[model samples]
Target: MRELSVGEAARRAGVAVSALHFYERKGLIQSLRTSGNQRRYASDVLRRIAVIRVAQRVGIPLEAVRRAFSTLPDERTPSREEWAKMSAAWQDELEDRINQLMNLKEKLTECIGCGCLSLTACALANPGDALAADGGGPRRWTPG
Candidate 1:
């Protein structure tokens, strides 16, 4: 099977070698060593790097990403079925986050019409906006 050196892998992944090393250190990817004592990675590592970057963009920490990857079999490359399942899980999480953000937007939009009284009841409200002087920030008035 084809393998990539650390530099080659990083170049193909469009990231710096140091970043690749960091990812390996963080358990986001794995590498094997050649007889010459140099790092080598399976060519499929490109896909893993892509997944790691996408997970990070979606606000998943490296630890969480590692844990998610741990659920997959490590004997061989992940099959299409495994990829589909993982992608589905991530999609569900993204959908839930989107729903939450939309809910917040709806609440803020409501505040514009409700005389901003709900601002006191809303936890996401900007604490410094007109309520800081009165100590109505999150510290003093916990959201319900």
Candidate 2:
């Protein structure tokens, strides 16, 4: 079983060495240590990195990626069925995010014409001063 050094893995994964370290710390990827304490990763890590990159590109958080990766067996790369199942689980969440972004775009377009940055006047955002009840911090624009 051949393994790649951290630098080689970073090059092949198209990520910085620090990013790989971060992923390791977050448990999204794993590596083995040599007798001299150098990090070496199995070639399967390239596939894992690719999956992580795709999930991140779609705005999935590292925590979510970690959770999804946890579903795979520790000793092997995810099989096609595992990948499909994970993707299916994320589909609804991604769709919800898309809808939220679309709604935000529409509101921003309306705000441009309305000029209602003033919370008191921005009925679209402030909406009957409901946020005032929440205290001093900025209110979240998106509902959970």
The model with the greatest lDDT is 2
Off by over 4 Å in 2: 57-59, 113-124, 127-144
Each model's total of backbone clashes: 0, 0
Quote each prediction's TM-score: 0.75, 0.68
| lDDT tens digits by residue: candidate 1, 27-94 | 77888898898999987688888878877676667777778888876658888899889888888767
Q: Which ten residues in a row are the worst by lDDT in model 1?
A: 135-144
